[model samples]
Target: MEKFFHFVSQTGFSNIEVSSLVMLVIGLFLLYLGIAKKYEPLLLVPIGFGILLVNFPLSPLMVQPENGQPGGLLYYLYMGIELGIYPPLIFMGVGALTDFSPLISNPKTLLLGAAAQIGIFGTFLSMLMLGFTDLEAASIGIIGGADGPTAIYLSSQMAPHLLGAVSVAAYSYMALVPIIQPPIMRLLTTKDERRIVMEELRETTRRERILFPVIGILVTGLFLPESLPLLGMLMLGNLFRECGVVDRLSKAAQNELNNIVVIFLGLTVGAKCTASHFLTFETILILVFGLVAFAIGTATGVLMGKVMCKATGGKVNPLIGAAGVSAVPMSARVCQAVGQKENPSNFLLMFAMGPNVGGVIGSAIAAGIFLAVL
Candidate 1:
């Protein structure tokens, strides 16, 4: 009877609290969303599982070493994030995979990308008014840019205490981009604006592609050296792809290296969402503000598209402007989907890619500015 009692006490059922139970349910819901609904499965799946793994009562996964006891496996893995390693590596892979030709061919779209940063700064000021410290506000505000890796990097640097909440909020909004962005795109643009077709982009030469990353790095290095860690890796990866001389390195960065880093990054991010870290009042506020920032970003992007449409004598489709958030190809695809719904003849994917890729760069620069000034 004594042994039996001891064994029962050792089980999770004995140690589970209300908070643990709540976190577990949240984890399961995330899993369902990822596996069943296919909403950013690559991101949500690992993150969801990490939430489950960490929520178990007396779970050793995140336990720190003490009194000669070794720490949990995830404790070691999470250091990559704590030390600001994974996000930049992920950016390198993104660079390897990105085709900047769209932005290069149409440099004007870069302004639409810059316009989206208003959400980041806007949220920053709002959070400050709400009483969050500059660091915390900066971290939370970054969620507006809709770039997970940049958010992770900045939050990890600026507000390590808020990392779990900031990371989850950034990624959650990113995953929800498809559901969240369409209405804003539709509300901002008229039927005629949605139906407008862009002229096909001119072919970009190999030399231009090759020169871009180099020039980009030099200019950024001179102006905003703080951004180099993320932007530098991004441009380097793009260089590897464009230079056409290091197929092996480029492929490795794009495929194997990128995949490995994402798994680690996702699981660690999820692991950070333990009940204590994630269930606070601040966490709730972060989530709410994050959604607002994203909505504002989407709205602003489409408004810019509208302005450009008028400026271009109706040559531009306002739908593509919504892709200015750094959610990568997903937001661009949403623009494509919404435009096609209005006019089956419209093909906005390639055109939207201009602002989409530009957003990635713009968000990185925004992060850099935060790091530099604050």
Candidate 2:
């Protein structure tokens, strides 16, 4: 009986707390959203599983080493995040997979991308007014960029304590791009604006494609050396894709390297959401502030599209402006979907990609500014 009691006491049921239980449910909810709803599954699946693994009562998964005891597996993998390694590598993979032709074809849309970043600065001020320290606000502010890796990297730098909330908020908003952006795109634009069809992108020459990344790195590196870690990797990846000489390297960056880093990044980020860390009043505030930041970014992107539409004599589809968030192809697709709903002939995907990639670069620059100034 004594042995039986001791054995039972070692189980999770015996050690559970209210906070752990709450975290467990939250983890399960994330899982459902990933697996069933098919939303950002590659990211959410690992992250959700990590949350479940770490939240178990008396779990050793995230425990630090003590005495002769070895630390948990995730404790070491999490160093990638702590040391600021994974996000930049993720950026490299992003570059490897991304084509810069759209952005290069429509350099003017770069302004739309820059315009969207106002949300980050706007949110920064709001968080400060709400009593967050400058660093905490900075961490939360990047969530407006809707770039998960950038948000994670910046949070790890500025306020490591807020990483989980900031990451979850950023990725969740990224996934919600389709849902949140369409209404704003419609509300801000006229039916004619939504129906505006863009000119087909001119064919980018092989030399131009190759030179784009090279020039991109030089310009951005000169302007914001602090951003090189992220942007440098991104440009390197894009160079691999465009150079056409390193197919093997490009494939590796796009697939193997990206997949592995995402798994580690997602899982480790989720592990950071231990009940005590994630359930605080501050976490709640971060989520709320993060949402507002995203909304502002989407709004500003659309508004900028309108401005450009006016400037370009209706050549620009105002909806493409909404793609200025760094959610990548997702935001671009949402713009296409919203625009086509009004006019089936409208094909905004290629056009939206211009601002989409620009948002990626713009967000990285914003992070650099924060890192440099702060």
**What tens digits encode model 2's per-residue C-alpha lDDT throughout 237-286?**
99999999999999999999999999999999999999989999999899
Give the per-residue lDDT of model 1 (tens digit) for 163-271: 9899889888888998999988888888988999899999999999999999999999999999999999999999999999999999999999999999999899999
Candidate 2, run of 10 with poorest lDDT: 175-184
TM-score of 2: 0.99
Error of 1 at 153 (Å): 0.5
lDDT value for model 1? 0.93
Identify the runs in model 2 with alpha carbons over 4 angstroms from their true place. Answer: none
- Reference-based lDDT, each prediction: 0.93, 0.93
